[model samples]
Target: MTQQIRRVLVRSFEDIVIERVPAPVAQDDELLVRTTVVGVCGSDTHAAAGHHPFIDLPYRPGHEAVGVVVATGRGVGDFAPGDRVIVEPNLYCGRCPQCRSGRYNICQELKVFGCQTPGALADLFTIPARRVHRVPDGMTDLQAVLVEPLATPVHAVAKAGDLTGRTVAVLGAGPIGLLTVVAARHAGAARIAVTELLESKRARALRLGADVALPAGAPDLVDRAHEALGGPVDVVFDCVARGQSMAQATDMVAKGGHIVVVGVGAAGTTPVRLDLVQDREIRIEGTLMYTAEDYRTAMSLIASGAVDTAELVTATFPLEDAAMAFSASLDLEQVKVLVTADGAVGVDGR
Candidate 1:
């Protein structure tokens, strides 16, 4: 008889529940990973509420995860049993032109592991060997879980070119927004401002390195961001990506500035003032998931003590309590919520 294990599934926001299924075995060129920790992302919550454009309903929900290898299949020699790893989650068709051009994040057949397919929110899950990165020797599960999330902002900051002494505004002080502050600061941004609805998140953004954190609903937000950064921002990392935030971005960014859309916006048209975009020559770019190089940069930053892992994770629930974890992730005061498997607690890899 096959062994049974539990995994969380989301049919809707009010319908998240744990379900048991047979444990999976590694296939060729794959590794079976036993999940240790999984971070609940803003996109996960959006998908649960049926708001995400790419992610559909009734799916396993774990993308940002840390795990240990339980088994390796044929052709997998890079990792062994007991090796710790972080899931990269972005799946791409190697034959795609985007993949051939070293931009597989936008591969024509690109599919995210947790979003478009089954993911690692279980006792055992098999993934392609190329999709998992070996965790550094002394990095804790808490820190490792952040690699996937941080890689995004790392990639976004790269799109903005060198930040050395550049002024930046990150709209939204959630996990991505707060991490954008960290990434921008690390890239040598001269000053950084953030806007969010919750005071707690604004405060957390300040602790994470923002020079100014303001209310997202402020009518004068564009001016406030300009004044806080000493002038119009040279780069605006729109972590909110809403119609209103895009408007604010266009208003606050200086002439010839760059606006990197880091957040996943809703599916539909969002109006943009093309006149302003044309007159000011603002460059608007959209960033997706990270590449292997960005993943390496994220790991290096985490290993170098650049990220405050403690400040980012607000709570953790057992694998059985994934529903509660998702609920906590939606809490206004929470920064990052995690779900952990048995024996994964207190073993911080310190």
Candidate 2:
């Protein structure tokens, strides 16, 4: 008899269902994992609502996840059954020019799990061994699930070069934006200010070490940020990629400073102030997923207590209630929602 596992599937826009499917088999270079905790991301919400550009309907929508290795294929040696690990969702072909140049995150033929491929929102899944990073002993599965999302901000911050003693501004205090605050704080930034529309998120930003949390719609938002930073911010991370936010980012950045685009918006194109960018010589860069080193650093930060992800988890639902979990994630009051498999809760009862 074939093994059967429960998984979440998006049948149509706003219609999510749970179904039992055959468990996948581990290939020669793959690891069979039992999904532990899967975090609901904004992209997942978009995909469910038929807003995501790349993800098609009837998709399994989860990318940020941590699991336990249940079995390893013939060529696998490092990981064994029962080892906890975080899954890197990006899959790339090693022969691509981008991969050859050591930038696999933006590979010529890149496919993201949960978007372009089957996701880990299931009881069992198979992934390449190279994409599985071991979870440290002290880190809980709740915290481990954050490693995948946090790696993105780690990579974004690294793209801005050295941030030591620099004043930073993060626009939009979503998961990525909030994590960026932790990353900048760990990188020795002198001050960090976050702009968000939700009061709860603003407060969370402060709790996460942001020096100041300002409302995104403040009439003098740029002026207030300048005053808070003692001048124009040295770096601006536009975590809300809408046109208005991008415009605000261009205006708030200090001359010759850097602006990193980290968010994804539904709009196909947003008008930017190119004249301002050209005149001030401001550096604008876009970051995709993350590299292997970024994942390592993210795990190290979580394990070493440099970043606390537990506070970000607002709610958790059993795997059977994945649809409800996804619904809760859309609320502004919630930061992150998780779906856990059976026996995933621990002594702490999380």
Candidate 3:
């Protein structure tokens, strides 16, 4: 293996370029993973195109990565050389009140892999021994890379408990939104409606079992969804996070229905119309990143084939062509574009 590894770093928006960074080192309680497939998330697109405010300069942007363990540091348990695993990415201070209370995802000092911390786009990366989850045996690296994004929808569904027989609407039939539709179906929602700007994504959503897929700026999106399901929706998983979708979510909810906001709200969009929710006496919720349980449940869904993820992987690119991967991810026909590296050691070692 080379001492220096290439990484996709973004020093400025529209200025993302690959560079050779020194390969990461591992210490006891850490594991060195040779990354394989990395999903280009919508957040990466937003950040790389200069839409988000939280990310800083010279950042390597990829959080959804799956790879094989090449070396495990001393004291690391339950893993060894050549184990296939997906990186959990969220690093938290265990001593924080949130972490102590079992809400590590919301720990005050949390830093996500590929966000505030170094991510898995490089040839080799290291993480706390606990942050690795073994990918199921014989799983394709494509399915492995989807674990992180898949977890987001799972967590959103979990947050909105007892959704059985409830009507659901997902605004934004993008990756997360489509996943939310799948999760809602798994939760036994009576009907699922998805909306998107792209006709191609909408068509894919229909194939993935959305009862209806709406145009992004549909004049009566909420009404149309309600009418399609024969009444106001019981839950609206607003995965677009933009004000328009949030507005539609507020309108789609029934009198006592829930609204779960799943998308990353770009830098400065504040949601409003509390009076509408207050009057309707609806439950509005905001979901952040996922927990370990969410990740596990997501992988289980994939392994069980409950989720037909074939339509989800709209495109793929090799590691060296990640810039092209990112470009493809922005295409109208793409739902997700993944960057992959060869897993030469996985089959024999796992």
Lowest summed lDDT over 10 consecutive residues: which window, candidate 1?
341-350
Q: Write the per-residue lDDT of candidate 1 for residues 25-49, one digit (tens) a residue.
A: 8999999899999999998999999
The alpha-carbon lDDT assigned to residue 9 of candidate 2 equals 88
Model 1 lDDT at residue 325: 90
lDDT score, residue 177, model 1?
91
lDDT of 3 by residue, 1-350 (tens): 44677777876555667677666778999998888889988888777777766666667877898888888778898798888888888889999899999889888998888988878777778888898799998778888887888899999999999888888888888899888887888888888888898898898888877898888788877778878888988888988888888888888889988999898887775777899888999998888788999998999888877667688887888777877887787776788888887633222112
Model 1 spans > 4 angstroms off: 343-350
Local distance difference test scores for all models: 0.91, 0.88, 0.83
Where is the poorest 10-residue window by lDDT in model 2?
A: 341-350
- lDDT string, candidate 2, 1-350, tens digits: 56677878887646888777777889999999989889999888878888877777779877898888988998887789999988998999999889998999999889988778888888888899988788888888887998998999999999999999999999999899999999999888999999999998999999999999999999899999999999998999999888989999999999999999999766487898999999999999999999999998898888887666666988999998888998898898898889988733222211
Q: What TM-score would you give candidate 3 relative to the actual structure?
A: 0.94
Work out how many backbone clashes candidate 1 has.
0
lDDT rank order: 1, 2, 3
Q: Where in model 2 is the C-alpha error above 4 Å?
A: 343-350
